[model samples]
Target: MQQPPSHAREILRLAVPAFGALIAEPLFLLADSAIVGHLGVAQLAGVGLASAVLHTAVGLMVFLAYSTTPAVARAMGHGQLGKALAAGRDGVWLALLLGIVLAVAGFWAAEPLVALMGAEGDVRSFAVDYLRWSMPGLVAMLLIFAGTGVLRGLQDTRTPLLVATAGFALNVVPNLWLVYGLGWSVAGSAAGTSVAQWAMASVYLVMVQRNAARHGISLWPDWSGIRAMTRVGSWLMLRTLSLRIAILATVFVVTGQGAVNLAAHQLAMTIFSFLAFALDALAIAAQALIGKELGASNSVRARQLTGTMIRWGAGFGVVTGTLLAVAAPWAGALFTSDAGVQSVLTYALWILAAGQPIAGYVFVLDGVLIGAGDAKYLALAGVANLAAYVPMLVAVA
Candidate 1:
């Protein structure tokens, strides 16, 4: 699919930094595997299981970003700089609230949750320790995630990506020291990742403030505007939580089956994540563009933006998914040397990659809906799918 007339260049403008920033995200995961991978499959497997659970829980609060992005963009589009800045402040408040709640729960429940994943012995100990040390990162991750959303909404993906890239680069050195030099095991990896996230979050916040100031937006919160954010954010929070739960449930069920299966699924998932997240960046671009277009009161432009995003998503699916399908063996090697894991991961990657075009449509359609502030449907759609995904996973297994 050709871009929307220089569309490719325009999209790349947002996507490049975004992709670079997001590269750190995969590094965060790959680092997790690299650390635990050396510890033995059992340890790797246990952290993998716990990480899935922890991410879902953190995802629950990520509504801060999913909800805030389009809104901020709309305000910016309408030339309501004050309102846009207010959105930023309220976002920090709401994200921190959700973060604090998640942090306390994650720390307290890390042990029991890892145990429930069926992890045992030293593996369980490693998972618990990793979670305990890594819980702080969840807050930072959410905040940074939401902050990125705000910036992207304004059609400024470059800054977030730059911040992400810097943080990701800084992470490698400390990780090497902790994992190989000091032999701190999985905890070292977790610590390294946590520190990296902290750096990213701080950079994002600073960048947003500077951008707002330069753009003449008030850098403080407005109570009245915050109420509007609340109204919009409520539906978003639910929608994000539902999506998070659905993915979480996928991990949960896979774990219940066994460690080998769970590890395979995780490896497949990590590989699939590259395509999914990359496509999401396209969705992010669409959300930023369409919402701002709508806020400019040009529904026609908004609809056009939506159409382009869907087209780009399909094109992206074909290109990126094909690459992943071809590279399945290499991805498996990156995770582990287990023959069972390699086989399962290889098969699962094909299944997921084949579905990318379909999944791509769903994700981009989601961006369209969210951009319109029609996120109620996103939540409802997931709830509606509970029956289908649950039964399908069981039947497929």
Candidate 2:
């Protein structure tokens, strides 16, 4: 009999492409920041503030992906392709419903949300504009999340990488033309990103539809399946919400400091997000692989995979942290020309760099547990984490 591939090999198979796809998601923000940063400090700060709100909203819905991935993977492991496709379809439908509601709410609440973030004057105006214009893309983003989850559960990360890369490339030109050429300012950047997001979502929908048809799965939304998804997702959402709250609180504090500090925080946060996603590739692998292993009732393989991934996560973190630390001073210049913002950003980047190893270890274990369908424990852990973090945040404030 032929021997199976090594655990590391299996992880890299998924992780390499996952890394590309994962980073591409954040590249959307990075691209926006790079493009919008040149407009002026106020513009960058405004986008930064708006993004925190946008990210918080979308982050809450991440269970669409997280819940779907393992559910589908488990079904597949049980040799139920139709059931897996059915589960994925429900995730897509749920995404659509939530996306529409969120888009409307986001559009209407744009100003209030920006104000709540402590934005004012030109920053407030710019933030509201970006937030409202970006609403359409919010729907697309959730769809992408669901669709990407479907593919990941099916053990195919390459397609997402392709779609995301194309979307990123598609995003740049329009943003440039709209912001500089048409002089639409922050609104233009938001519009361009929204357009690209829709395009990517379209591709994912087409693929999902094709798969469903091939598997003889109905395209209609199964309310029952969606309910099941949400049931599992609630715990995951709570887990995710805790993390978002931490991030939002950080932004809230920084926003109070002044435009320069807020702008610097945004740049540092964007870089931090970029690195976080890069590290999360291994986590993504863990989710898919561990879920499948557990579904197949192979706890031994699951545990082995978990150990290997943890090591990889830590090692990858060290390398990324070192690079980030080395790049801290110069990295700020890439986003903005403002000397004050650049100086503050350098300090933030150094701090972020120092935390990467811990972040990496946490991310992988989170994925491992998530893959195991241990959502309740994760949710409880999230609360504890938030409780611990809040005091530190208060001290900083």
Candidate 3:
């Protein structure tokens, strides 16, 4: 057998830290779900709907990280430190501007959005309250996303790992205090999360500022640079939005099935998302390494890195999938005791496990292409994928 690549160590260094950072947010949400679950099914359902909306909104702006990583990595790879820092700063500006717009829109549109999701009665009311209260946090989330991008581009995943770890640790105390100690219910969970998010964003801003000062880069926005970032970001946004639509469509279909189905789906999804952390970390490493190599005009090394990542991703997926399959018997017990929910979740876990290897390949390929700056093709592919998935969903429904 061929020996493993000598650079496997570098990939692990990046992937491990990136994985920690990636899992932080989901872990926070999982904590919230666990706490709110005891309050009753309606509240849990409410939190699920609100979370779906918040996730979709934030997911659409993930380009803040995705676009900045490649742009900054490419610039830095070419030894243009100043330009790299400048590009990162532009991403921050764009993130702030877009965050404000999205916060306001999502807040005001919360009720109708929930209604459109087929939520009703107490579920709708609770979802609206949670979503509206969480809007400010979305701003913090967007800022953190962009700042994390800047740090990743400079080849420093450790900082994000530290910050995310600290932030997530801080989240649990407030969540418990507000949700149980103070009796705020689902709204309290939202409040605690919002506070934690802003705290994380504040820390990230300080770090970014110090880095900028160290490099003698201006903190002020550059319209031209911002526009350039947006040019790439727009395509990413489209691709991201298309993915969200696919998820939203799935949620809609599940909702029509009834509250029990939706809740079970939510639990299964949470598990799937947690597993994605590993794949995502590898993908992130691929993005940074591939972008850096391509930026240095080392196409051959970039290809080699891509190949290595795909292999690792597949191997990791198989391992994770096996674990998921073994744990499937006990996975449902952790989320809920409801017979109906548990029944559905058992099968869902197996399905999710079986698909893990395919997911791993797709995730790795996606990051490689994104790092190659093939945003337009990715956008078109997302649309096509959605077009295909929708009909299948309809058929199943």
Candidate 4:
């Protein structure tokens, strides 16, 4: 039961692509921030606030990807290729259905939510445009995420990485054209992002099939397999659903504070998110390696692999966190010129960043637990976080 030295090395190599792809997403957001920065403080502030509303609303549906992967991976390990594909397809269906709901809500609900967040005249208009513009892209983005899960779960990282790289390029291209060349303003940027998402989704759909076929698997869903997948994946979906709701509640509290306050909080949260998502790929990495080891009946290997993931997650996420704190002012300035806004975000940035070390452990533990098929434990953990974070944020408000 001795740990293999290659386990850590193998995991790191496989994870590198996912980590790179994860980092690219925030970088794409930063591109928007950079584009809007020159527009004026209100535009930047408006974008930040609008982005938060969108993030919270659409982000809740991301459970489709998070919940789908382990089920697919586990099924694949059990020689249930058809079930693995069914799990993936069900995740896509969930994402599409959820996206339809969000799109409807986003189109109709944007103004009221903006007003509720105390968005003023210019800000309210910007938010309305941004949210409405981005609504159509949600399904595409979710599909891309689910597609990524399939690749990651199967330990095939290059496809997602390549697709993400292409998506990043897509973002840059349309953003340039819409924001600058066509002078479409914030609405154009949002539209451009949607375009990029579509590109990613399309590319991933094409790429995933080859990856699947390589393992003697098919990417299409089977009816019987779908039923089986749904039975098991429901709990995972619920576990992820609760966590997303908790995070959204936190954003709601921040939004309720005031637009200026919300803008600041959103910027800080965005900075933190960029780091978190980048490192969370390490968790995905851990899940894959752990599941692989468990399938191979190598418990000792799984433990060692999980430790390696923790080490890498801590090292990378912690450094990024520290640097984010140190550069908070400049980062804040990029998104806003309001001195009061800068003052609030500077502190929040550090506080959020400071938790990275702890979050690193939590992220790795989450992966290990998921890989071990300890979903009930995760359900309990999610419940605990929900109970605590909800009350804490409410009290702070």
- Model 3 misplaced regions, further than 4 Å: 1-5
Q: Which pairs of residues collide in model 3?
A: none
Using all chains and alpha carbons, the TM-scores for the candidates as numbered come to: 0.92, 0.98, 0.97, 0.87
- Say which candidate scores most in lDDT: 2
Query: For candidate 1, lDDT tens digit of each residue in 84-133?
Result: 76687678766666778888988999999887766777767877988887
Looking at model 4, residue 1 earns an lDDT score of: 47
TM-score of 3: 0.97
Return the candidate ranking by lDDT, descending: 2, 3, 1, 4
lDDT of candidate 3 over 254-338, digit per residue (tens): 8788877887788777777788876899888888988899999999888877888898889888989999999988876776777
For all candidates in order, the CA lDDT equals 0.76, 0.92, 0.87, 0.73
Off by over 4 Å in 2: 1-5
Top candidate, metric TM-score: 2
Candidate 2 lDDT score relative to the true structure: 0.92
Model 1: CA > 4 A from native: 1-9, 211-227
lDDT of 4 by residue, 1-397 (tens): 4446787668777778877777666776777877765665566667776787776655555545565667666766677766566567656655566678878888898788777766677767887787788888776877787787776767777778887788888897888789889998888888998888888887766665665576565555555754654555556666776776776566667666765676676667667777877777788887777776776677876777877777777787678778877887666777667777788988888788788888877887787787777877777777787887777777887
lDDT tens readout by residue for model 2, 1-397: 2224687689988999999999886898999999999999999999999999999999999999999999888887888889999999999999999999999999999999898888899999999999999999999999999999999999898899999899999999999999999999999999999999999999999999999999899999999899989999999899889989999999999988999999999988889889999999988998999999988999988988898889878988999999999999999889999999999998989999999988889889988988999989999999999999999999989
TM-score of candidate 4 against the unseen true structure: 0.87
Q: After superposition, how far is residue 155 of candidate 3 from its true place, in Å?
A: 0.8
